[model samples]
Target: MGSHEAKPKVLILGKVDFAHDAWNALTQICDVLNPASTTREDFVKECQSGKFDGVVAAYRTFHSFGITGLIDQELVGAFPPSLRYLASCGAGYDQIDIDACSARNPPLLVSNVPTAVDDATADVNMFLILGALRNFNAGMHSLREGKWRGRPALGHDPQGKTLGILGMGGIGRNLKKKAEAFGMKVIYHNRRQLSEELSGGAQYVTFDELLSTSDVLSLNLPLNNNTRHIIGKPEFAKMKDGVVVVNTARGAVMDEAALVDALDSGKVFSAGLDVFEEEPKIHPGLIGNQNVLLVPHMGTWTIETLIAMEEWAMENVKLAITTGKLKSPVPEQVDLQ
Candidate 1:
């Protein structure tokens, strides 16, 4: 059949209220179908049946059995080859198996709303930093237990302190602005050096130099082969004694066991985490540490960020319908490639 004669059958493989009038705008352009939930059987059946032209993989609910600690292959096995494009409805594609998706015949087009998470991520990073500095988690629990004190431990000031960023992506740039606003000396280490003009008062530095000189460090790099456990015991040992650390990036980006040890030994003064190596099941040692602050992976949970992400994700899906392409295409070097 001719392309114009055949309408694309777009399916949402996760729970999304596309039925909402505002969200249904795309339905006017294609035959939209959203199953309340997608099981392995359902996904395979749809693909084998040649039913869908594109799919919006909602990252929030698109977890496979492996990620959920269920059977691994079963969840991944459900993906249908019928999908020409997969639109990730969030800032990151960590949930979707991009490599497998790209191996398809036409090469699945993977795209994400990468910009929407910047403000929210910056806020969360800042929250973690302040919480760690003030020992907020410990003090809050103590206060709830009626252990009132004249004053809690003093917190470190960001002003005039060296702030180091592990990666200088969108979130890192936003954070650099925030750090500079507080008079913190910002420095960073990235695989590729950004132009000096856009470094946001952040000096380019060697990884070791960043670790040794910074009073505070925030990791913003993507999780990949070279970066997995990028901050382990060896890296931690290079940092100044009593340095503060915060991670708002992917969980596995740091070595949880090493971080716990640093906290215990006072090699690190305090740490804050919005993500973990094994999410939902954080390292138990950090749980009881008075020097650590933990959050349940809420870096991009703000209302504005969610709305912007959903809208941009829908726009990405719409691009496939109109041009047979994706706007925020996953780079060829990404795992999905």
Candidate 2:
């Protein structure tokens, strides 16, 4: 067998879904050392030993790995001299230690499948909006309890609701289309306005205006310094009473305490959350709240997306290790390479 056919040492960090597609895609190029059912500590030790050539991190194992438990500064010491690429399975790279990786003598090429995740996330956003507006969680709970919620558990209609999107990027745009399909009027507040054509009839509104006017507010903004706690108590107070809030974005983007408070005060009618500020450690206040639906960050949790992500990640790892470049390095690292 050629050296290329020989399995290269690949380190698995945290939890990766060890499915047929994942293994087939990864194994075809390099051997996949996946210990998905194990603890995060073991993965850390493996990488730190510096014997691996490629590192793989995934999103499907969020429930097992917990929030922000993957790649971090503490685990950066494990990058063996052989390590060249740190391939992330999804677009959300908050768990990564970008600075630490960059400071290494030979910086790690961090790659994520950004484009492939948009449609899946957008589908999740619509699900959140519909689920929250329709109070699906509450109705389901009431039904399961052998009690008919009846009129008391009535859900709002999406036909005429206004959906205010905080970010108008790819995921946001896809969500707008889906929301509009349900007869919703889409409005958005982006860092900068997109061209008229790209807006797709989504009105350009100021952040405050969007907050006040939206009957359904969807948080799709990226997590960054300026966007942290973008939706808090003060912002909630400006929204339409009983507004539905859906967050498929990062948990820290909205203050969890504020969301719980708003839910209690009826400022937010219902909340469908796929991500939390302290994820896997859901806010205690949101627990048992009939108006809240919590998903363990499964916005991009579909077989198609997962397999595609794995394929892209392996391609990135192979390209980086063999050609000294990644197919899809994280945006900031693009310039560095």
How do the residues 257-296 of candidate 1 rate in per-residue lDDT, one tens digit apiece?
9999998898998999999898789788988876688888
**Which candidate leads in TM-score?**
1
Best by lDDT: 2
Against the reference, the lDDT scores of all candidates come to 0.74, 0.77
In model 1, which runs have C-alpha deviations exceeding 4 angstroms? 1-6, 17-22, 35-80, 150-153, 333-337
Span of ten consecutive residues with least summed lDDT in model 2:
55-64
Could you report the Cα RMSD, in angstroms, for every candidate shown?
3.7, 3.5
- Name the TM-score of candidate 1: 0.86
Evaluate model 2: give its lDDT.
0.77
lDDT of 2 by residue, 1-337 (tens): 4864765656554454634564566557656565432556766665565445444322223343453265666766655666667777777777676877787667766887777889999988888888888888887788888887644468888998889999988799999989889999999999889999899878999999999999999998778667889888899989999899999989999999999898888888899999988756888899969889878888888888876776677677667656778888887688878
TM-score of each: 0.86, 0.84
